[model samples]
Target: MESAVLTQALMRPAAYPHPVSKVTLIETHISQVFLAGAFAYKVRKPVRLAYVNFASLATRHADCEAELRLNRRMAAALYLEVVPIIAGPGPLDVRIGGNGAALEYAVKMRRFRQRDLFSTMAEADQLTGAQIDTLGRQIAAFHESAPVTGHASGHGTPARIAEVMEAALNGVAELASSTEMTGRVAALLRTRAGSLQPAFHKRLASGHIRECHGDLHLGNVALIGQKPTPFDCLEFDEALRWIDTISDTAFLFMDLLHSGRQELAYGLLNAYLECTGDYAGLVVLPFYTAMRAVVRARVLLERAHQRSAAGAITTAEMATTQMRCNDLLDVACFALTRRPGAITIMHGLSGSGKSTVAQRLALAGAMVCVRSDVERQRPPHGHTAGGGDLYAAAQTARVYRRLRAVCCLGSGAGFPMIADATFLARGHRQQFASLAARRVVSFSIVDCNADLATLRERIAARTGQGRDPSDASLQVLALQQRAQEPLGSDEWRHVVRVGEPAAVE
Candidate 1:
């Protein structure tokens, strides 16, 4: 990686106006970043690529400014301002931030520890389910507020999305030596995505297609203030940033799998779905994840190709990168060739860990979950949040029917589904089993049990929380105890017994 004059000058602490004893320079395929003092300055390299052009100083300056503005959307506290590298008295001498004619520009950002980066933490096996869950909720909140593209903008349409995917496939096909599997799996994804044309349009019309963090992945995120914050978005490409929210989500989902964090991937998916209530996105989620993996493989291979052609990487390094690309393609293959879906329903009292078991099962098997409590609490199509028939018999039956429908939707799309509720009645439990039988997918029930003391304690604590969607009271628990129907022997074969142990002193 040969450095230009400005890059070399910027590698010294003296180049920055801040007082620092040393400097560190990091180089990527498209940019050179100089980390010194309490800030990091990123400068795009003078090179043109298929996806971005920074060959000219003017283009690079514009890109730097755009990077600062776009990244501030998510991490406003971290991104500072775009500053110019002014010419010094000497031809090769340059310094950052001045009033002279600019030689190059850099996006100045408040620097955090490299170890805090999600990619680095993941490498150390330090990423936690809690962090991933928080990150998912964060993304959901951001997407909810992100601006939507105008009707005239062609982004997020089937044609526009296909163009992006087709270009990625072409990149992989052109760069990789063996592209048979790539073409095959991609073809299957294309066909599946094609079948969901109306649904995609519906998603677009429903405001699911909005401006988003285009390059969302573990590498672009870091732990800041004990929270995972994202930076370094796809600033130069508006078409990539303005996309379906699920498509943005697929980037992290694919990244987690590529890193072999399968449980975290599922955790992120479940958290995002639960936060946004965007279960319909599950239909095309696998397709988007597959395409994201393909895009990843192409970018890696392309960057490796560029470096190898420039004599920057050794033959052995190039071989290793090729192997990495192959692994990425393998993730894409898994996304496409996933087996038929399964169904699991939670059978327990209100405080018997039904929700907890559903959450765990979702991570264990990449399942989509629907809870009776949440649906019961969720307002009707244009109604205010609450004040409906809290526990009317008709409302309870409606909630059960909706749960079955969500399971059907997810299972039909080849994903495991979890129905979390106190299925004390045989009829409520039978609805999910019947749907599984009709869909020809596997079905099972998780029967959770806890002592009376634990159930009472949990119910009391949850009631105090005031945030739980369940309206069940202590009196309601007593009623459930009396009215609950025990599972008959006929249902034993499909039951997975899970006991919720009483909490310890």
Candidate 2:
């Protein structure tokens, strides 16, 4: 194996024995990727960075194998095998079984078109809520089956988390819009880090820390055969890969928000919670998201520095990069702000704009929403509302009971929460108020009132839409109007109106 042979093979596609009509070479800071026909080959550079070391042939071989093994767990069909680039006596060739000593190792993968990439789809506005839902479910399932890294693993401790945060802050401090802002954020992060020490310890004790896809973002995910598939996980460092499961998810959540897909971010988080029943994870989300933001800013700064040093960056390009870094820092600061906790219950019939208001509130970072329509159609409440016993007296009571119980559980976790439901019965409304009182959280009712004609029209239009979660019809609205109870004088102070200019009663 000679250096000249390996270099020539990398530069010229004619070096390989296979038919190569066209070739493309992609180079990153630490790797070189060659795309030929139907396969992509990745070779790690022989360099040592602060976080990873691939300076020796042995180290490169190990890291290449690690990349292949870890990525195959999620992208099974995409990751093929690690093949050797042998320097034969005549010419360099990629051989399966030969006696020639290998010059380097490359991870061979089944390549798909760039259009299938999630990043590409996002640029084309092709990223959909359904795709985000599939991604959430897939990641949740993967985390559930991942190996747990508990306190014994010593990777997800509070101190370790603080180290990562500090590193990220230092990494991007020079590139930030203001050094004072960076210092303030660093101080705030330290303060919060101390506060979350107990939470980190608790999650570790509960086995919430596990081996994860450390670099989860839009660019790392792709749609293969119309299904969301995550790939290209962090493989060089164990400290990066072994993390709290929620922190792993926060990466994608932050990426979606940064990409201006706020609704999809909320949907993804809600769907993940539905799959894992890990609503408690919400407690650490602010910190996790902030950390993710800092990490992203650091990466952007690194790229900007590299381009500037290479004289490839224009003044406008550098300004845009700086703006992006500033934006991410702002997101971090916003995520760190403590939001008020309250129980906001929506009281209205179907199509009264309750869901719309609740969704808007959730997107505004006010609270996480729990909708009755979506819940009732799932699990034990999987009943066809009409002829079946679903709307029967006892069954209706059970549904409300379940909804109230879910609200209680969510509020107990210390998050601001919105319970979206048609609280037509005084008993049901009072039940939530009492629960909120017991939890020591403020309770408010939003009266999503509209004209009778408007409500009827909306109901009919929604029913015809066919994909709405609610099964309510004009008949349901008539029954509700006759049976609905007005808020008592005692509850007036806590009531708000959604459809009016003035929100409060």
TM-score for all predictions? 0.95, 0.78
Candidate 1 local distance difference test against the native? 0.85
Query: Which pairs clash in model 1?
Result: none
Q: lDDT of model 2 at residue 271?
A: 74
Backbone atom clashes (below 3 Å) for every candidate:
0, 0
Off by over 4 Å in 2: 1-8, 88-99, 174-177, 307-316, 348-367, 371-416, 421-486, 489-505
Model 1 alpha-carbon miss at residue 231, Å: 1.0
Count of clashes in candidate 1: 0
Assess the local accuracy of residue 64 in candidate 2 as a C-alpha lDDT between 0 and 100: 84
Cα error of candidate 1 at position 306, Å: 1.9
Question: For residue 89, what is the lDDT in candidate 1?
Answer: 62
